[model samples]
Target chain A: MSRLSINQQTVKQLSLPELIRACTAVGVDAVGLWREPVAEYGLVRSAELFTSAGFSVTSLCRGGFFTAADPADRRRAIQDNRAAIDETAALGAPVLVLVAGGLPAGSRDLRGARAQVVDAIAELAPYAAERGVRLAIEPLHPMFTSDRCVVSTLAQSLDIAEQFPVAQVGVCVDTYHLWWDPDLDAGISRAGERIAAYQLADWTTPLPAGVLTGRGQIGDGCVDFPAFTEAVLATGYTGPIEVEIFNDELWKRDGAAVVAEIAARYPACVGTAS
Target chain B: MSRLSINQQTVKQLSLPELIRACTAVGVDAVGLWREPVAEYGLVRSAELFTSAGFSVTSLCRGGFFTAADPADRRRAIQDNRAAIDETAALGAPVLVLVAGGLPAGSRDLRGARAQVVDAIAELAPYAAERGVRLAIEPLHPMFTSDRCVVSTLAQSLDIAEQFPVAQVGVCVDTYHLWWDPDLDAGISRAGERIAAYQLADWTTPLPAGVLTGRGQIGDGCVDFPAFTEAVLATGYTGPIEVEIFNDELWKRDGAAVVAEIAARYPACVGTAS
Candidate 1:
């Protein structure tokens, strides 16, 4: 389980300490933490809690949402992302995942919104790099393109990432967000060293209303994990394969049980064989 | 209004006769029909009803779903598609919109599944052409990529359509599906003469649990109808612009009112302005 990191949101019911304990119990030494929980637990203390427990902080959960319509909202988003970068540095996380925000209220200008994301990133990437936190532009699924992230394809993520230095910016690869893409293999290959974070979550059907929390657990869906892992790994991406499912059903279950299920499925799915 | 067609599904609350009345009430003389509804109304009767009402059958609603796991099922699908082609010809509809089926039961081979679609289409295209029905491959939104339609982008639909003779096969340009695509303009331009049908539906958020019926009315959501219509019309497509929304809320409303709303929205959204 060396390469497997339990992204905290996958088992959101657990406290930071509890999450760390569970990961260690399952021999998963790596954990990806979200900014909210880290803020609640005290970022410095959280860092110490993970490091003291001999666990590696894989990556920070988020630091994007850059596409607000209003000028003040846009400014706030960039400033908040900058703070997330500082937190990423403090926590010793290598990357701060960026979920590009959706369109402004009732706006049809998708091209303009996407440009705003790039502008926000250009403003923040240098700050993030200076703080030693690489920004990972996470391209959410196209379903969420209009309301969530305009960056919907891995190619689009890489296109934005390629603009900056590789050390400062990279693309986040989440199978749940990207498995349907025919050009996924090419995107991964192209992402090479720019692949900062590699996340695992499956795409299940009958997506829940609002389509926020329907991500399937690894083996529960149709994603070919071995195929996906092989492609990502082939790109010299020796980073943690973070399990970051957002299923509403899973959240109702015991956090430990969920971790156990994820631990077992990882090796069988995108783990050792791949 | 001259270019506008009231797709039957847009006002599904109406019976075949009621739909014809509703359309004619609002001065819309063009329509696109679905097979199940046609079968319910008696295909010949439905054809006659539209013709007798002086309504032009713009295009038949569907006939694809080719990605079956079993060989026998594949054959059945092809046979059913052939019947649909005949129905289109009978209704004097020049196009048969094809919503390509999703992955077979418990399958992850998207490439293989897509190939199955091409194979099925190849077998049916000639028969469709002989019967004077052009099969329009309708690339659904990528959200339905796994369960509803594997063909999810305008470019991909064009790719499949280009393989067949332009008259025998073409692409369906639905605003709801293709609007999110960055390369949509390119795809529409490339599809020029190969554009068989143009469908309009707005993309609304807080998508319903099934996501099948979340499509908004013309001006109800984010779709810039004028832009979409301009792009499609630029391709020399002189066919009826069909309003094919699948909103649950719209379905609950009075069919005649919905038709009136659509009729009003058409001129403002995609008609005279475009």
Candidate 2:
């Protein structure tokens, strides 16, 4: 194993400090911490705990929700993202994950909402660059187009990234969000070394409620992990394959058991050793 | 008013004969008949009723569930599509819509299933072309990728059609299926004159169960209809904008009233009047 990073979303059931302790106990290599969890543990204490355990914060979970009808709220969102970048920097995380906001209230114009995303990102990029924080735009599934994200395709994400200089802008290629894309290969090729994060999860059929929470664990469903991993590696992404499952069933299980199960399954799905 | 077609699916609650009478009462210009409706009304009587009511048969409501594991069943699917072509010919529909089948049962290889779809279409395209019936591949919503069709992208559908020698083998650009595509403009441009149908409906948030039947009526949700209509027209598709909503709410209404509502809403969402 090169290194294992458990996305905090996988063990969302655990507190941030508890999640860190759990990762250390399992001899895990890294953590992808979310905002709410950090707030719960208090950012200062959370940083102290990670530092004490010598844990690496691979990335911070989220700093974008840019669509807004009001300019004041939009500006506030940017400020919030800047703070998120500062927190990520303080925690020694390399990238700040961004879940671009859904449509403005009562707005049916996705293109218009998408424009807001572009403009917001363009404005945020320079500030993020100054802070030495890479803004990794994660393309959510198309089903989220109406209410979660306007950037539904990786190509679109890359296109959006092109507007800003490559130094501080890239994408988080989460398989849960992108497994169904027909242009996935081309998108990954275009992404190349610019892919800041390589997240993995299986896509279960008959999506439940078609929301953010129905994600499956690696090898539990249809994603060709070996093939997709090969494609990502071909693009020179040698990062840890971050396992980030959002299974409700798994959430209900014992956190330690889930972590062990994931640890066991990880190498089988992505390892060269058969 | 060029030619109004009542897709049998629009009034799924009513019997085929009842739907026919309702279409007649509402002064519909034509009928897009479904297989089940045809079976109920008897193909002979369905033809008789359309002829008597002076309604043109615009298209047949589907004939392709092509991806199958068994070679015999695959062959049977072709034969069934041939029958649909014959029924289309009998009822005088210029086009026979094809909803290509999805991942085969107990299979996770979508790529293999898609290859099967390409081969199946290649075989059936020739027969439909010879019979003077246009075979229109409807690129379904990505949400239907698991069990409905492997051809989820408009670009993919156009790629498949490019294999056939004739222009008659084309695509059906349904708004509900395609509105989320970031490469929509490029796909529409490629479709050009090869687009056989332009179906319209809005995409609602938190889609209902039996999602096949949960589509919203035109102008009822978030799709930019006028913009989409303009793009399709830009591709040289000046065909009738078929308003094809599969909503339970619309189905519960009187068939005549539903037709009236569509008639009132469509022109607004379509191209600007000269």
Candidate 3:
């Protein structure tokens, strides 16, 4: 119960104040937040508000999109990421999640795009570390490879993280994005202490358009939460297990009700595996 | 030009006679057939129709789904796969593409399901080899990993293929599925003589529901066809290069027109990468 955190996107319909209130109602003391809504709520105010409300910021949603080939575009992306890192620091979030951007328009060089990700991270990692924030490389599912992320496997994320200082860079483990991997257990074992943040969203079928917003609730899909939780826990990870869903169906429901449901499912589906 | 094979699903709107005429009109002498359509057109008749039309059958559509946990269900799958292998032989298709089944209902054992695929293939490989038909394990995109094939990488498919006699088993290299993989080059190089069938499809986004029919037309998406062709060709794979799109828009168009577009795009996007 203490380890469960609800990422704001799971109840996207709620405003920051609404979310905080809902969490208070449901006895959720922690949450993961996205950049857009956090900014909308006034960053410093939200940070102060969460602290006063007794909520821990598990992670900050994003800080990457470094695949642009154009130098100017790349510079803009880097600047934006630096701002994100600063926001993460200000919000008392130790981890800033990164979604490596998709292929630039008309680009065929996936290798080139991936190289760009490495270079950008190299620039940002030091800044993030100085500010006491860790950059979490979140490998989206392969369906998003061309349009969202080149980092599709946990092993690949670990490969990037290993090149940097262990304290500064790490990878996000999300069941929704990685449940399909056969080499997952090995990758998780290898990730060990480099595990920055742990998230859960089940793999549901008939994926909707854009393949985004179709994530299932914890118990509604095929992912074995116990096995994943056990693997991450085996790595000595005592961090929060964030419930991060992007389902349109869940978003339309009452935010408090959704949080309550998540609180219930966390125990039943993700059981304490230690 | 001589190596191009249009899989039936690419132009699924066309009947057997219509597809034959469409190919003849465009000077296409090779095709990949699907089991359902072939059965619909009569197995013996499809074989006769194709042979008399001077069309080489590059590969038969499918023959796997061995993840069922029940003994009775497993036996039925084995029987069905045997029939598919027989159909491959009858059609003069040297390869039978196998889409390994997803998790059995309510099961979280992805490793176990994958093992089932290998075991079923082991059972079917000798039978396929006897008939001069090679089993080609087709690892679907990770997006299909749950409801379709648990085998999500060419490397994983190759891992399974390596277990059997080279003459009896191999893998289908599909551009759409394998393009996202960073280790694809290594997988293709390792495949070498075991590359039974080479397939092409682009990775367009904003994927529709079910994700079954959203495959892109050859040059319509992000796949680098030349890179894939060069790698496969470098493996000494001289088999027909199949264009297998599952696009909804393409299916709605005149089938002959779609084939003509594929023929044009094959040269432009795929090129003669010898």
Against the true two-chain complex, what DockQ does each candidate achieve? 0.78, 0.52, 0.84
Q: Which ten-residue region of model 2 chain B has the weakest summed lDDT? A: B265-274
Candidate 2 per-residue lDDT, tens place, A1-274, comes to: 4567899889788877678667767778688888888988889888888888887888898999999889999999989988998898888888998889888877867777788888888888888888888989999888788788888989999999877787789999988788777888999999986798889888776666645566787888777777777788888776666888888888998887788778888877775622
What is the TM-score ranking, best to worst?
A: 3, 1, 2
* Residue pairs with backbone overlap in model 3: none
Comparing only chain B with the true structure, the TM-scores of all models are 0.98, 0.93, 0.98
Q: For all candidates, what are the clash counts?
A: 0, 0, 0
Tens digits of per-residue lDDT for model 1 on A1-274?
A: 7789999999999998899778878888999999998999998999999889988898997887888778999999988988899999999999999999888898989999999999999999899888889999999988898888999998888888899999989999999988988777888899899999989999898898989999998888889899999999999988888999998899999999999999987888974555
Q: Every prediction's TM-score for the first chain?
A: 0.98, 0.95, 0.99
For residue A27, what is the lDDT in candidate 3? 79
Task: Look at candidate 2 and give me any clashing residue pairs.
Answer: none
The regions of model 2 sitting more than 4 angstroms off are: A271-274, B271-274
lDDT of each: 0.89, 0.81, 0.92
Candidate 2 lDDT, B40-81, residue by residue in tens: 779988888878867777778898899888999999998998
Report RMSD for candidate 1.
Answer: 1.1
Tens digit of lDDT per residue, candidate 3, span B1-274? 7888999999999999899999888789899999999999999999999999989999998989899879799989999999999999999999999999998988888988998998899999999999999999999999998888999998899899999889899999999899999888998999898899999999898899889898999888889988889999999988888989898999899999999888877787766684
